[model samples]
Target: MNHSLDGQVAIVTGAARGIGLGIARKLKADGARVAIWDLDVAGCDAQRLGFEADHLQPVDVASYESVERAFGATVEALGRVDILVNNAGINGPVVPSWEYPVDAWQRVLAVDLNSVFYCCRVAIPHMRARGGGRIVNVASIAGKEGVQYISAYSAAKAGVIAFTKSAAKELARDNVLINCVAPAMVETELFREMSDQHIEASKAKIPMGRFLQVDEVGSMVSWIASPACSFTTGFTFDLTGGRATY
Candidate 1:
């Protein structure tokens, strides 16, 4: 697939590193002008140097106002945004749903789920103005299968999938397509943060006996964001390295 994303302007959140950075890099390589958004300004700068993309912005995806401001500035600087990738996320402490801290649960929901709302709420208008656009959300296998120890993260990601579906249906009428990619045990900084035992257990359960690569996920995201993905709105593409069979 040529998947020529050339001349498109995009915003990718949590893009300082990991899968988010991978998506940004792939989009840029496909010829999109990408703005990398991250909470860590220093990390964003370092990643920017590494990729040498079009732009970077420090954004708090959980705050609607902050998202609005950052996105506003991004559009003003980049001219317009045709693609939005909501990839900012955090996995709260691993514990049973009944025992998880209330604050931690709320925080996880805020970042993983609510941030999607914040970004879309702001970006939708821009898409409207542009006549059409694409939004590719970064969901997870936990969203579909409901991971045992990470109930809050699972629930929040599940919410993202639902939101993507709803938004896709609503926006498709206006030419904006929304979709999500759910990956399992991707080898990224976030995956490396897991406990050694958990990592071993995760590897053992995968049929591939290994984690998916970031660039692999990036390829799927790039396609979803491209004009080539027409006619498929509000769908979840599985990138789980065969672990997400249902």
Candidate 2:
């Protein structure tokens, strides 16, 4: 499928590496000018990565102030914001719910859930000014079917799913579409934060018998962020390899 985002400008959070980077690469490949937003901006090689030097934004999406600053910078540099990918997140410690530390739980929700709200709050006005836009929030199957050990991650993602739906409805009349992707386990650096047993268990649940690839996520997100995805607002598109039947 040729999902062309020609002449558009996209802001992808946490895009310095892993799945966020994958989404940024695909958006760039599909003809969108991408602004890479991440805390590790110093680690990115703009020339090597094919992103413009001016568009590399060091942003902490969990903070509204930081998100606001980044949004203004992106608009000043890129001219407009057509797509917003709330992809920055952290997989908190993989301990059981009761054993989950209080601070760790709060941190997970701050990054995974609150960051989505913060980014959307900052970008929606700009997108409205631009006439219309697409927003793709990266959620997870854990949100739908709660994961045993990662309660915080699961809860945060569930919040993302709900938030996407509500935001989509509010923007439907304004042509500002919002949707979310509920992907299963993707083999990223996040796996380093999980236990070996949890990893195997997650993989075993996938009918595809494999973890999701980053490019696969990019491909789906590219379509969702494109004009072709019209008529699909407030939806949770599943990328769970059949692990989630709904």
Candidate 3:
């Protein structure tokens, strides 16, 4: 139960705000040197949140060059990356699949799915050299069970879940544990993109009948990112408020 990350270094993408920010906060509290990788560093409040001022790295997760460059900078500043949280994502639109914008769909997949791969592709080598590490991709319940109208979001998360599993198997012998959390809904700024009707309907599906709290998700990631989460790799830990019976 000791989710201590003492002496560890963690990189959390999409951390300018919302769930990613919460995860960064938790990691810092648990003793890890945390880096916030996002488009805008100022919005993440790294200093105010008690994170090292030098740990902020501006990055566009959707771009491979940007992610790679930031990774190098993070290493230069924080030394090494021992943990990676692929939490960057977007809920493109509420329209039906038939009516979705091609550009929007592509953008959603790029940020939500491709970026995870991009970051992992870069982090895995370093982790192997260090003999072990943790990678936690923030998935969603929609990935497990396809929702009614949010096709792009659901598909992207599902890919994240699958990628976590595949990548874990490849790194298991090396001791790099990789996993994901399939959350139903977390109250964050991302909610601004969701329609009220979509939010209520999604909440109704959860047996808990409420939106998840960002810190709750953050706590889960903290445990998964720590040495305490050994013996589990390429797995999906449910955080759907009793909604994920599987």
Candidate 4:
């Protein structure tokens, strides 16, 4: 239960607020030095966020060039990267698939799905060279069971799940563990992007009768990212509050 990550360094994307911030706080509490990576870095204060000022990185995870630069900056600032949490994403527009704009679809995939690949592509080599590491991709239950209107978000998350599995297998022998978390609706700022009807419908699907909490996600991810999660790779850990049993 004591998933101590003492002395490790973790990079959590989109950590300026919401779930990313939650995960970063948990990692820091567990003894890992955390680097908060987000586009809105100007709003993050070291004293306010409880992280080192030097470790707050302004990264655009959707861009490979930006990812590479951020990775280098993290290594230079934190000494090394032990864990990479691909948590940056957007809900996109809550419109029907047929009505979904091509531009919106591309942007959603780029941020939600492509960003994961970009981060992993840049971080895996460094982790491999350092002997081993953990990568936890934040996926969604929509990926497993596609949501109605948010086609782009669902498709992007599905790609994340598949990517995590394939990459995990490739790194299994190298001591690098890659996995994903498929969570149901969590009451974050992301809800602002959904309609009132969609919100109620999503909540109704959960047997637990409530949305997930940030701390709940943080706790699960902390365990997954820790050495305590040894022997598990290429797995999709569900945080769906009974909406998903498999």
lDDT of 3 by residue, 149-193 (tens): 999999999999999999999998999999999999899887889
lDDT score, candidate 4? 0.93
Tell me the alpha-carbon RMSD of every candidate.
1.5, 1.4, 1.3, 1.2
lDDT of 2: 0.91
lDDT of 1 by residue, 135-205 (tens): 99999988999988889999999999999999887887899999999988878778655788777777776
Per-prediction TM-score to the true structure, in the order listed: 0.95, 0.97, 0.97, 0.97
The residue-by-residue lDDT of candidate 4 on 141-182, one tens digit each, is: 999999999999999999999999999989999989999999
Reference-based lDDT, each prediction: 0.89, 0.91, 0.91, 0.93
TM-score between model 1 and native? 0.95
Q: Candidate 2, after superposition: displacement of residue 43 in Å?
A: 2.6
What's the CA RMSD of model 3 in angstroms? 1.3
RMSD of 4: 1.2
Model 3 spans > 4 angstroms off: 46-54
List ranges where model 1 is wrong by over 4 Å.
43-49
Q: How close to the true structure is residue 218 of candidate 2, measured as C-alpha lDDT?
A: 96
Against the true structure, whose lDDT is highest?
4
